[model samples]
Target: MSTLPQIEPTGATGEVAELLAEVKKNMGAVPNLVKVMAGSPALLKGWLALSGALSDGVLAPAIRERLAIATAEFNSCEYCLSAHTYVAAKVAKVEATELEAARDAKSADPRAAALLALSDAIIRGHGKVDRTVLADARTAGVTDGEIIEIVGNLALNILTNYLNNVADTDNEWPLVKPRTHS
Candidate 1:
């Protein structure tokens, strides 16, 4: 059960309704997370603006989706993990093994692997990443623009992950359990 009211598009009015309409047009449905966010019209609008802007960033769609999953897994946000896993498989066409690797932040592609490592470090370090980490990403051929975009994407995931964590949002798709380590 969501801690916040899940505002349906039909029930919403004004800015909230417009935002829900946009979400439906873009994603084919108003996801429950978005519905929860709709409780605050400003939050929904801000989320949509940030998401739309970052969608045009330099990262490939699969890589972005993979990062989203990795962030969700790292944060133990079950809602985001399940949602992004669906997007990764159905929308991004990421392979099963690749999806698993991505969830672990260990992509097979060297460049992607580097970015994933940086992303994990950013989360673990709480954005106080070490200089060596940046150096490694650069050595792995991550450009300045890519690095900025990586942080942006990470911030985006953090918002959704934190929101889901706080809201205890119900998993609307097949549930993805948090990855356990030995």
Candidate 2:
């Protein structure tokens, strides 16, 4: 039971059309992923609300995307990795080099490097971390507040990462750096 759904555009009316409108009004287009999720009206609505709220969270847009990419990468969720990598580069201003490093485990940005490490630790189910990781995070200017937010943000990505893995959602090519093939 893959997550992808075959949609009938004409079938979209009433509640479904309204939902599509909501997406289009905000995103200028309704993404295929959202349309697939919309198969369950409640799920579509639930994720939409969560997305809206995440949009308003204290984390910078770039950091939020970074967390998402790291989680997806660690989970080996190509679906989420492809999607967020695009957003990170296109909308969130994440650098390609940083994203590549994250994928290859060679991250360069100190703050993002710390986050990539944290993401790996969490994904690998590491029992504990050395004090130096925390020290690195501090030196990278990641506040305790940000750390808490990172955990919460990573949780959000975990949900979607797992969903996408289970779903087998079709790839949407990179909108950021053309031909880079993230």
Candidate 3:
């Protein structure tokens, strides 16, 4: 059970209703995360806005999804892990091996591996990543723009991961649990 109420789209009104409608139209369904976020219209709106902006960012959709998976695993947020796993496969078309690799903050692609390593470092170090990781990322052709976007993506995923963990949010997608819990 969720610690927070999962606002049903049918029961929502005003801004909440409109936001849910937009989410449904875009995603074909209003996920539990958005439903829970609907409790605070401001939060829902901000999440939507940031998510929308990031979709148009420099990082590829696959990379963004990988980052989400890595963050979800590190935070032990099953809701985010499941949701991002579904999105990574169905929407991003990431390979199954790649999806599994992401959970470990790794990739077969050198650039992607570098990004994942940086993401892992950021999560483990609490934003105080070592210079060598940044240097390695740049060596792997991760541009300054991509690096900034990586931080943005990490922030976005961490927000959802922390929220889901706190709320014990119900997972609507196919469940994907973390390999280890902190």
Q: Among these predicted structures, which one has the highest TM-score?
A: 3
**TM-scores vs. true structure, each candidate:** 0.96, 0.77, 0.97
User: Worst 10-residue stretch by lDDT in candidate 1?
Assistant: 173-182
Look at candidate 1 and give me any clashing residue pairs.
none
**For this target, which candidate reaches the highest lDDT against the unseen true structure?**
3
Model 2 residue 23 CA deviation (Å) reads: 1.3
Model 1 stretches astray by more than 4 angstroms: 180-182
RMSD of each: 1.5, 4.3, 0.8
1-182, model 3: which lDDT tens digit per residue? 99999999999999899999999999899999999999999999999999999999999999999999999999899999999999999999999999999999999999899899988888899889888989988888889998888889989999999999999998888989899787
What's the best-to-worst order under TM-score?
A: 3, 1, 2
Model 3: residue 41 alpha-carbon error in angstroms: 0.5
Instruction: Candidate 1: give its CA RMSD in angstroms.
Output: 1.5
At residue 53, give the lDDT of candidate 2: 79
Worst 10 residues of 2 by lDDT: 173-182
lDDT of 3 at 79: 97
Candidate 1 local lDDT, 1-182, one digit each (tens)? 88878888989998888889999999899899998999888888888998899999899899999999999998889999999999999999999898999888998889889989998888889889999999999999999998899899999999999999899997898888878421
For model 1, what is the error of residue 39's alpha carbon versus the real structure, in angstroms, after optimal superposition?
Answer: 0.6
